[model samples]
Target: MSRARRTLSATVTLALACTTLTGCFDESSPHDAVRDFLVGWQSEDYDLAAGRTDGERAAVRKALANAKLELDAASFRFKIKSVSIDGDESRADFSAEVDLGENNPLWVFDSVLPLHLVDGRWKVRWSPSVLHPQLKEGQRFAVDTKPTRRQPVVDRNGASLQRPQFLYVAGVIPSQLGDKDEEVVRRLSAITGFAQDRLLSRIRSSPPSKFVELATFGRTRYLAMKPKLDTISEITTQRQEQLFAPDAPMEIVGKVSALTPETEQKLGGPQRAGDSVGQSGLQQAYQDYLTGSTRTRVITLDLRTGKESALLQEWPGRENLSVKTTIDRAIQAAAESAVDQAEVSALVAVDRSNGEIRAVAAKGLDEEDDGLAGKYPAGTTFSIVASDALIKAGVKPTQRLACPAERTVGGARFAEAGQVGGPSPTFQENFAKGCVTALASLARRVDAAALAKSAKAFGIGQSWQLPLQSFSGSLPKLDSDADKAKAISGQTVQVSPLSMALVAAAVASGTWRPPVLVTEPSSPDPTAEIVPEPPPQPVALDPKVRTALTAMMRAGAVGTPAQTGSGRVYGVAAPAGDEGSRQAWFVGWQGDVAIAVLARNHDPAAVAGDFFATLHDPS
Candidate 1:
């Protein structure tokens, strides 16, 4: 054979052998296989990732199935920094960035993936520890949360608003009583003042081993029924610390209860059953701040060995923070005492100087906050706004206007309650007497928009960003003369007790300042720190208009023959038979304190007077 021919044949044969070797093996290198496996795992494609594992496919699938520590898969990202291979074995190092949640801290970790050769092909060595160092075979990840202790709610003076009091919980243990359940329930009802049928139903539906709660009673009632209740075997009593003040305002302080499904869903995090949460009032409004923080831990539990170890994630619990309010205890007590007898009533007091709400009290009302949410026609109390509008319209308080027996406008008739028209009465005189016919007569003389604008100056129908949910009065558009007349007499306009209190405060301070309840905290912790809310921009009142409104209020409080006194009670009352219910309101300021009292089917002026008298003399 020739030398050239032999050399060319050997070169061709070597080239062909190299080509066959390349084609026989897969195109993906060891690094590429590892990278694809990691990508599949990050994307939550457990089946695709498991396919890359040799003997640990079942273990990898089990780990994915048992993973309870849910994280946003999209937020998980990783990049392979380097891959080193010796023979058939390879090691790939990568950095991973994991997102937890808004309330949780972000996680960053570096990990190494080990690959091995099996049957001349590289395959990932799957293990639970690949996901987390602490994980083991038959181990699963879970998050455990520990909630912090509840904080206290304080008044302006820093005194605890929720006092430690005895609350009698009446419940029945079905198994303990056996056949005596019916008799015991009957006796419990007779003593505890609960319905017998309700207790019986609760007992009947409950399991034999469980205790079913029926009702809770206050200290006085519990003490009165203790003798009879102690004799019943099925009945049990438990005393718990709750918000309780015999004379403290109930509606403003509010109440707490077990977490409802709605609140749990709203909370959107780990919360245990039977946890006490605020349901209404300021309690519900400041739940985040008051609830504190919960400790969260990601742990891996080995099902086979029954051993558990914490993963890389950990969130330490935070301390509870107290919520300090601007409520004055003395004023709240006085307001509560004032409305103790009224079937439906509310009283609110504000510091005229800084617009700090001092007291909020309501009685014989539903669970909803009635002190700031109850909508009622202002009746004659709205004359404050009308008087301001009239003055701004160049109408003097002394301007003579007719007060007839009755006047009809737009088919809506308005009449004077007590006195009929003998002649013409000055605007100030009719205002003091609360003459609806007189105000309605001049309704056509003023613009309704101007009236509403003037009312806004007194903080009526203004939106307020307060911590607690409140209704800051609302004014409907009045295009017709009759609507304007009704609005002027405070008939068509609806106002809350808090709104009236603010009106009186505006009249006294000559500037409308939104009411503030929570005092800003000085804590360094971001969670504990109270974000400073911008103070409401004050609305200035015209000096001339302010002076006229003040005089008119004083005149109304002192009756027809004006009497001189340090304390002034100025407000208006509506006829009992006119609107199916008697409504009255009195709003006035004494020194730096401005207060409003609203009563339904009762005299509000008298209630305001009594409240003031009690304020001056608590005896």
Candidate 2:
């Protein structure tokens, strides 16, 4: 039986009761009894309604209570349409409206509630039909659902990206569980919503080698629950890998996880369990467009006969529509193949012209998005900003700068990059070669305010209208000379791969616009809110600075690893650390596409090289 929320009043007045019925003389009229009974039933006060009914009051109360669950009702209302009275017997014709769950149509019908006068009072003679006209004795209402087929999330060319993700069992190796068995059991029961006794029994009868499966989850669900299970040593879980490339693109394309109850309630009402649902990425962002349409059948089941006796209502499910994205299939495939197998690496490619993010791929699903929002020192990538500042200040790309092994500016020495000097290399050449000390020396040319202003112009410390979560480059007030030096060279700066990709796009294209992952959010008219009608234009860079920066990057990529064989791609690759052990970079594009490959602990130049190589090659 469903829990009655006490939403309706239990009392009824003689005037109101007599209006619908023909004969009623006073408050003691039998019409008042029928009124009270109908009011109680409509309000879901089962006990109050049952008391005014005759013939096995408890059984009648139960049938009334069971109506909500049997019909999966969101709402139930009863109205007295008309009544006929004959001596001691009366027939109350009422309108019954049983509302099924969300997306399904309402079930409406007319039924007669029988009543009789006894000892100067009237009572509703309750029967199964009193609850629902079709429901007979020992029959209940039931619902049947046809699972929605998920449509594939596609790329710019309409290539499918949706695929089956692995299911993981979150359980314990019986022997390895040891002393924490009780703790594991309790936690698993809570996580899985399984009964405690049933789960405890299963835990007790499991083999050591065979993992005692407690609960199975899709990749998205398992990853979400992994943190909660970390402290429990006995709770063992196998890694959930994607069938493609060790894993499907999660932080970008998104993944399907178990349909959670909390999410279900928000989606309208409780839905059937064990269905894979979009947990994040485009799958979640465009949930309404992807799998919102559903088919539902509402019927009255003959509980004693164990068969559906009548069809109360039917709502047809429509085919799920596909979600077209900004991702390029070729670029996504190439970038996925280029991710470093040894370390957590990420790549983000965006259109330089309009800032449409074309591809995002990552290896190792870490807590933070290493590809999109992961924050790290920008390394030599900061040179792009420094170059912007210096070039704007009349510093030419061909101007020869100092060749220093180490520099002590503002009392803080910057010797992190060992030595990057090549026979009086030009400022642009040194900056392109991942120069550290030279950049520190050039920090004297521009003050902290100028640097911050230039960085801001590059979209640092800015908000994105984009849907995905990302970290815009952070540039605090450059307080001291040391701060200026470090910030100029990127030793103390924090940036994400996505933010850097936009930075590269700013340099590649004349202007920098916010990134758009979902190209076609809505069918005919794209979502005005997400896709922004009259889309935010790319912030234009200074013409002179853009020209100088472009040429410098081309010159810098001369013999560097970021240099592609096609030579159509021009970018910079730089690493940073005390002993150069912390290899990091901000590498991107010169053409229509601007890319960023982010990683910590190793230089991702090789990954960047492999990515560009694929783009230039014809399969």
Candidate 3:
């Protein structure tokens, strides 16, 4: 052959070889098709995935719709593990890591997808099982969560804090009310004492198909007005348990109710509608311990039979545990009775020997835990720290001091109710008389750091790691002479009743012991041993200072009209002229108990004496 014929033949052969190789590489394999389909499905591209399936595209779309509804707000991620193919058939194995919620365990499962040849290309075989095995047509994935029973709160004496009580829940179904929604709400408000406008607004904002709660009432109160409530249309009532506390010192033990939107977000999980959760106080603080664990299971629901079958993953909930607190019933009752006469009053008593909080009582207060965390100007009650600082600074109790009518510090004047004209009174006598001028005059004598250090020795202005929230009081930095005077005289310092009581306890015991509320576990676990927290480092005081302080307080308690024979009560009232409101504070120690009483619009000495008198004679 000639050179030109050979060149043409070689070029045509090379072109055919390149075309054949391109066709072999471009043709879709069963394994590649299955992998691509899985990628689309995992990415939630249901439209793309359904198109990659066989003639059952409608079925695939339906299954995807059901899955979207079941998953709801949950987030999930998928991974294609391996794809195996043999001729016209293929199998794609995959796994999904689903996030149910914070309270629920993460759900991880593996599934397989079956693919077959359709015409000339491979396509996935659509079925509910492709999402999860054991799921059939019309069946969907659902999570069934069963929460454990709520445990009870008990006192130190093992008495149940909660009592069984009946309550009526009133609500309205907006759809059933139709056009009479406003009228029905007005009638319900009239019968139940709920706000008419608020109830109407709630009904309007709620979905027409949902029931909006109006109010809750005691069973007896609801029953007496049942006839009047019945006259309103679309009104509904449901009876349920409402926990009550007849013997509790305060209303901080807490209550439970159906989860609200706010609570649900704060405490995330697979919580269904109507799940009860703690709403306040100790119940809210120890919700996880009180409510225990929740049983979560992924189930395949049969739409036709209304039955459910578990899909391999199941978790059993643990039992709830009770919470035990250190509270003496007798002391709590006495404390409650002591402040019953005042509109706003609080009292705290601690065992001087062990620092165990025995009682905490308050009335007409809005804050939690008997207002132990409430802040107020220390007033003359803070004189305890002033006395300590003075004694530590070598000021003798017998040292004669002038009790002036008024003294000025840091551009603020300090005065007392009854100031002596002469200057013959001793330091002990001046403190007993609640002489703010005398204490203010000596503010420049002691170092500011030394005074603050002395105050912290009594557990004031110290950070504590406690199971429950509390305020130990705070002492601001005294940078000026006037600030020091105000702090020493209790005019600028703030304190809680608990901190004041602890001051008295420390004075009585000569050492500060951190207070403890929980002595033993409410729910004992045989397998788990309870570990006791180490005691706080002791803050020791000079025995001479404690003795002198005790003697001074006793002397101050003398001649008071409300003084009782059981114990001496030393206290002072905040000057009414300086501040708009008057607060009386009394702190004393008797036998092994140290007590502090704070009353608004009442005499602290009188209230303290009355409380001691009641303790002496329970008849």
For model 2, the superposed segments whose C-alpha errors exceed 4 Å read: 1-36, 39-48, 54-66, 74-116, 125-144, 164-251, 258-269, 284-289, 297-320, 341-344, 364-368, 416-423, 447-449, 522-536, 577-581, 599-602
Across 1-619, the per-residue lDDT of candidate 2 in tens digits comes to 1112211221233234335543543456566766678766766677878888886778777777666655546566667777778889988888877655445556678889888976777888877777767777766666655556556788788867765566665666655666677777787767766556434544543223445555656666677878877767777666544322112355666766655545444543323333346677767666656665556776666545546678866778655677777888787777887775437778888888888877788776342266667777887788888788888777787787675777798887866344445567788877777677777877677777788878888878777655556777788668887788888778888888888888889888878777777766544222334544553445788999999888877776666566668656567887743435455664768457788876656457767778888777736
lDDT of 1 by residue, 1-619 (tens): 2223433544554355444434543445676566556665655567766777775677676565434123321144555677778888888787766543324454667887788888877787777666765666665554444555556678998887775654566676655776787788778767655556445644543334455556566667668778878887667787766544322554555566544334444654333332456666666666656666666665555445434545557778555577787889888777777776578777889999888989887777632366777777787778888888888898898898888878897677987746633587888878877788887877877898889888888888777767666777877789899888888887778887788888888888898888877774432233545665564588988999989988887777775211224665554444322434466677777777788777777776666666676777788
Q: Could you estimate the TM-score for every candidate?
A: 0.70, 0.72, 0.75
TM-score for candidate 2: 0.72
lDDT computed for candidate 2: 0.68
* Model 3: ten consecutive residues of lowest lDDT: 1-10
Tell how far residue 11 is off in model 1, in angstroms: 55
Of the two candidates 1 and 3, the one with more favorable lDDT, higher being better, is 3
